[model samples]
Target: MGVQKEKLVQVPRIENGIGLMAGFDIRVIQEFADESLRATSQDDIVEKFRKESRQFGFDYFVALSLCDLADPPEDVVWVDQSPKGWDQIYIKNDFQNVDPYFAAAVKQRLPFVWSDCLDRVQRSKGVAQPTHDMLDEAASFGYGDGISIPMLIPGTHRGCVSLTGERPDLSQGPRHTIHLMAIYLFEACLRINKSALREWKAKEFIALTDREKHTLQLLGSGLNASDISEVLKVSEPTVRYYIKNAKQKLGANNVTHAVAKAMLYGHIEI
Candidate 1:
């Protein structure tokens, strides 16, 4: 008998209830102890996601323009606020002090739902009423409500994702949905960012000489010069010579640095 045709499974339409005025942007930032050790091409990664977000109905998506690895200031205007043309406002008026969303996101390391901004007086203490006025101004631009999700990589503090929109009635359900999407988007971005970093490091290391490359491979394998000499059938002095030359070519202060650079460049596994 012919296989029975399977019935079409019904799929429920999951509505986020987020209108055109609501949208999100994810920002990933990582800092290596050595500035040279930094990983991730943030611009390329952001561009990649900006394209993807369009398929998901995002009205607009942007990558935060990061200048340093330091955690962004709590009230940095463009860093926290949404709505077109805020970049000019942030730059011209210096709205950092009055932006509540940015302050809450950095301080709490939690998402700042738009509804949370309703407690105006309590949230804007000490700051000038102008700051509150600035927020009210932003609300006029379809950003009255939103959420900011802090994306913390294990060793980093500056990574975060911000979701914003004009939906005044964004309840727990839509909030959770946006939060979940932001988490997934940020996770993917992290992977791509790291991969790009590794590639760049590998390219930089690949420019080493043949002798340097050999020395790095042996060192990465945990072999001493004497052991390397025996393995490569060269004299101990010759092995030491090669190691020294490799270190110089790699601009390494020591054998350890050479090995680390080699591993970073995909020249050696160890």
Candidate 2:
């Protein structure tokens, strides 16, 4: 069966302030978080995510660890619940080289729908023809628009949780809620694979103020100090001060290093 696009309608925006979870069902998010915290194994996390994904209209998902891997690695933390035979075709064609979603995942820090990223990539110069070809092939297997939540790991490694189907909710409320869930699920995956957590050894949890954490998150999302200041409605100097304070607390050599450590320590979400 071929995938079908869902017609989107403009919905009234929920009037919730930033840093609040007023629009979505907090109980459901909390329940998922509690369940994720209790998950002791990779299988547990996978099962939990699978069950919850359907609520948002996704039938297939891939929780991938993107490093220097040219091919899929044999690791427990990497979960692939994508369509059957998609992997075989992906490997045969070396689609990894031109997979637009993977290309976007490493650069993006927030959850984004596939079409948005694809459109951006298409508009860019020097885009490969195979990128579009690969996506068309995916649609042949009932894969259509989906969401990819990008996670910036401590080291060079990045992570992405993508949910795909013929049609899924693309509204802001679901996007925001899924971002929260993806954070917890990624943490569970890290917990299941102890080897992955070795380098991120336990240290005294440096407490960062809410503003500081929010500043680092915006920074991680590729915002400059001025951009962050504008977003937070603060002066540029205040934004720089928050970055400086966070850097000192994390004992980082620079702002980028501080953001990386903050992500590693779970002090902020990107």
Q: TM-score, each model?
A: 0.48, 0.61
Cα lDDT tens digits, model 1, 116-231, are 65465466665468776887776676654556666655643445566555443355544554555555555555555557656776577557676667767887778998888888
Give the C-alpha miss distance for residue 224 in model 2, angstroms: 68
* Candidate 2 weakest lDDT stretch, 10 residues: 195-204
Residue 194's lDDT within candidate 1 is 52
Point out the worst 10-residue segment of candidate 1 by lDDT: 27-36
Q: By TM-score, who's the top model here?
A: 2
Candidate 1 local distance difference test against the native:
0.56
lDDT of 2 at 172: 77
Measured with C-alpha atoms, the lDDT of residue 107 in candidate 1 is 62
